[model samples]
Target: MPSETKNDRIFPVSPEKNDTQNIELDLLLQAVFLKYGYDFRNYSKAHLKRRINQRLNISNLETISELQNKILWDKEFFRLFLKDLSINVTEMFRDPDFYAAFREKVVSVLKTYAHIKVWHAGCATGEEVYSLAIILKEENLLARTQIYATDINKSVLETAKQGIYSKKEMELYERNYKEAGGKGELSNYYTSKYGSVLFDKSLSKNIVFADHNLVTDGVFAEVHLIFCRNVLIYFDKLLQNKVLGLFSDSLAKRGFLCLGTKESLKFTDYENKFQAVDKKMRIYKKLYIPK
Candidate 1:
């Protein structure tokens, strides 16, 4: 069997070996589901393999089997692995054009509503959630809005609820805020101390941070908008469809759905159920279809 080097760790590569690894991976995910109730069984295989490989290198383990044993017996180790699997890569006002479009297209319709309920699914670390709040505040809609930001990872949700971020990211966040049509200086929204910036607590006053798994959880609220960016790409097609169904069921009539740039409903079961409000930014409005 041939071996390949990844992150300075050698992994055996062969058709038979790969087959064995696949089976082991399936069993590992099943164990995680049965024990911890975290379902990654329907996640993208490539993503799973990459993250598992990284964990293997970090833990100095050679195979998936060893990692599985550690996860099954050690609750702490599983928590660390859960962090690795959770998609926590996010930034304030990420994909500025998307926010800009949301401001131009979605905010107008949102203003017509008496009260707005926003479900920011997979809101890792809450940067984007605050970004949305800032936009709503500027539009004078924050007071009428209730934002529900949920994530599968409890650790990241804590960080999101804290509303504190490293000072190093301010430059980029400021740029994004400006590009997203921020009315005032991003600095005005936060105060800096000891190399960290704590965003204004007022920004989170209307926001609720909670634990909700899109995979295993059912619809909790009928929302006017759902912002689930860059998350479906991590899921396989079946899981994506399942999640889209959940979103469809959860959204109110003519509500909005925003996805990451790389994701879309083009080939999904709910493609026709949504009409693109800003196709370039992957923002869509739910279409009310009569049975």
Candidate 2:
């Protein structure tokens, strides 16, 4: 006997189905990885989706296939897309309360160490890196400390290395500074030139800004403290756990981990590896356990 299927029972498909956006997105990610060597395949789907949608609009293309065509054919589009893709929203002393809490807590423990190694993961535009440098300097540890400031975006990394920022941001940064228990006038940190600011050169001299991916990359340095603020929010649970494991592995024994206010390790697999140093701030102290 033969089977007769209704016309409406067909699979009904278009080669351009949006759900295949995943397949298309993987292609584009591969293209970027091969062409630019910046791998972003592990980033959460929501983060990638927003960036891809924005890029699709900019290219005036309704579908992922169209976007891929343009991305493969035009290099400039990828450059623009890269800027929009990597989250770069940052400002000096972003969370005054966090800094204040760190001063009252983490710095006290750090004072006991003869030297310090800090890793500022995803250091957008270098504001937080410089902020840490200033704090370490005031604490008399800057001279004995080394800082590694890393981000996946090259453009923002360049800006971070340059240590230049819009002078207009100073008012807000200053308010944050004062709120963070700043010891002196916030203006003392930088000199205004034209409409921009050039932070003191001494602040970033010990900082090394480099390209590092939280995914698909090995640890570049041993660090006593790793401050990865506001970065894990965009990552899915899997990537977040992977990054936490990497941080925990890279961290020196009994090192400290400071995360953003909204981010925490309570749900992560590494939860048992680190003890809460400051529960309110998500600052943790790597517990001493025999291997």
Would you give me the overall lDDT of model 2? 0.84
Residues 1-291 of candidate 2: C-alpha lDDT, one tens digit per residue: 544443221221354565677787888888888877777777877778777776665566767777767767788877887787888888888889989989989998889999899999999888999988888888888988999999988889999998889998999999998998888877787888999999898888889899888877888888999999999988878888999989988899999999998889877898899998888888899988996
lDDT of 1: 0.95
Against the reference, the lDDT scores of all candidates come to 0.95, 0.84
Best of the candidates, TM-score: 1
Candidate 2 structure, TM-score to reference? 0.89
Name the best candidate (by lDDT): 1
Total residue pair clashes for candidate 1: 0
Note the residue pairs that clash in candidate 2: none
In angstroms, give how far residue 67 of model 2 lies from its true place.
Answer: 1.5
